[model samples]
Target: MTLRSTLTTLAAATLLALLPHTAQAAEPYPDPRPITGQEIIHDPTVSRLKSGGYVAYSTGGIIGARLSEDGRHWTDAGNAFAEPPAWWYEYNDKADPWAPDLSRRDGRYWLYYSVSSWGSNHSAIGVATSRTGLPGTWTDHGKVFTSETTDTWNAIDPAIIRADGKLWMSFGSYWTGIRMVELNPKTGKAIPGAQVHHLATRPDAPYAVEGPYILKHGRHYYLFASYDACCQGVNSTYKIKVGRSTSVTGPYIDSTGKPMLEGGGDLVLEGHGRYIGTGGESVFRDRGKDVLAYHYYDAEDSGTPKLGLNTLRWTKDGWPVVL
Candidate 1:
C-alpha cells in the first residue's frame, strides 16, 4: 500500500478509538442462561438463602415467589405473604404488591415492595423481614416510604444499596423517573427529615423510565434502570440502561459523559431474538460472579413473561456487559 493510504487508514482507526463506546455498532444481546419449569415472573428480585438454594419474589399475586435448589431449575413456591396487609388497600383496591426487592442484612432478609394503582401517583413502598429468606416466612414491617397524588415523583420499584456504611433506598417511576432517600438502618425505613435525592430521569414528557438497581463495583457506583414502555408483552419496548458515578448519589454519567438526570445512560441489554422487551433487572452476586436476573417476554411462547438470568461481565473500561 502507498504511504499516503496507510497514513489515512491509521488516522481513521485512531479517530474511531477516541470516540465513545456507544458510537460503535452495539453487539447483539446474549441470551439468558437457560432454565426449566415455572419461569414466568416480572420485576424479579432474587437472593441466595442462608440455608441453601435461591428464592425470587416478583410483582404479582401477593408478591409471588419462586425457588431454585440449583439456580438452573426453578419451581413455583407460593407468595411471600399469605394475604396482603390491610394497609395496602389504601394505595389500590386490589391491595396488590409489585416489584419486591430481596436482600440479606444483619442475619435477616429484607424485602421491599411497592403498591399502587395504574396511572396514579399515589403509591407506597413497604418492607418485610424474614429469617430464612424463603416463601411464606416474611413478617410485615409496614410502609417504608410513600408518595401522594400531589407529589411530583411516584414511589414504586424499590431497590436498596449499602454504600459508604450508610443505607440508601432508590425508588420511583413514570412521573419523574428514579429517586433515592436515606434509610435508618436500625429501623430499616427512611430516616426522618432525610432529604429525597433525584437520581435519573429522561428530559421528555412522561419520562418513561423506572426500575432502578444500584451495584457498587470497584470505585464507581453503577446505576441500572429500565427504560421505555413495559408490560406490553410482545409490544413492550423495555430495555436496561446504565450509568456510573463515583458517589452513590447524583450526577450519574453514561459513556458519553451525559448526566443521567437528563436522559443519559449507556445501553446494557435490550430485546433480541426470541427474547422481547428484556427489562426490570436486578443484580446479585452468586458464588463470586455477578448474575443479572430480569424478566423477558418470550416471543415463541405467546409473549409470556419468563425469568431471565445472565452472567454480568465487565469490560476493560469497567462497564457491565451480559455474557
Candidate 2:
C-alpha cells in the first residue's frame, strides 16, 4: 500500500480509539431529580403504560399512587381503592397496604400488594387489576397468598415476572428469606399444584433481608433484595443488594461466589449524603434502559420517604451495578 494511504488509515484508527464507545445496555445511573407533589412513597415500583405515561404504586393508605409523564416529575394519581378490601382488615388493623408490585400482562395491569401490621408475619398478598393502569380503576382480587403467624416465612413484598411462558412470583421477608411460586397466567393466582421454591436469605441472627424483585436480563436471573433495618427515616440502615443465577428458581450467588442462602449479596446502592436507607427496589425496563426505581429516606426533608430512580447497568463482567 502507498505510504500516504497507510498513514491515513492509522490516523482514522487513532481517532476512533479516542472516542468513548456507547454501552450495549444500561446508562450511567443518574442522580434522581427532586420529584414534587406527594413525593412520600415507600416501596415504590414504576410501570410505563402503553400511552407513554408512567405510574408508580407504593405502600400507604389506599395504596399510594403517583403518575409521571417522563419518569421524573411526578404528581399524585390518587389511591388504588377508595376503601381497603374487606379481607385486608383481617390482617392489618387499619387496612393499609404495602410494597406493591405493578406489571402489565395480557394487555392489562396487575398489581400485587401486601397487607399486614408492623413486625407481624401474618401477611397477605393480593392482586388488583386495571385496564388503564391508574388508581380507582383497579378491581380487587382479594388474597392471592397468605402467611400465618405459625408459618416460618413472612409472605410480604411480592414481585411478579413472566418467565418460560408462565407467571412466577417471589415473595417473602425476614423469617426464612425469599421464596417463589408459580402463578396461573390466566388467573394471576398461584398454580395450585406448583410448590413454593426457596430462593435466598440471611441465616444469621436478625436475618435482615426482604423485598425480593427478580428480573431476567440476558442469560441470568437477577434477584434484588433489601438488607438491614428500614422505616427509620434518616436513621434507617436499608440498602439494596443483589445475587444472580442462571435458572429463575435459583441458588443465587453474589460477585464473591457466595450463595445468597448463606447471607451473600453484591451491594447495588446504599446511603450517600442526603439519600439514606435506599431500598424496596423494583426494576422497570423503559424505552431501552433499565430503571431501578425504589424509595429512599430524604435526610434533609425531615427524613421523609421519597421516590428514587436510577439506571441499572450491567458490567461487561456480567454483574449489575447502579450508577
On the 0 to 100 scale, the lDDT of residue 284 in model 1 is 91
TM-score of 1: 0.93
- Please, what are the lDDT tens digits per residue for candidate 1 over residues 111-206? 999999999989999999988998888899899999998998998999999999999999989888999999999789999888999999999988
User: Candidate 2: where are CA atoms >4 Å away?
Assistant: 1-30
In order, what lDDT does every prediction score? 0.92, 0.86
- Clashing pairs in model 2, backbone N/Cα/C closer than 3 A: none
**Residue 48 shift from truth in candidate 1, angstroms:** 1.5
Clashes of each: 0, 0
Best by lDDT: 1
RMSD of 2: 5.5
- Local accuracy of candidate 2 as per-residue lDDT tens digits, 1-323: 99999999999888654432233123333466556666788999898888888999999879988988977778987898998889888998799889999999898999999998888999999999999989899999888888898988887999998888888999988888899999988889887768889888887867889999999889999999999989999999998888899999999998778999999987788887888999999999888889898889998999999998888667666777665
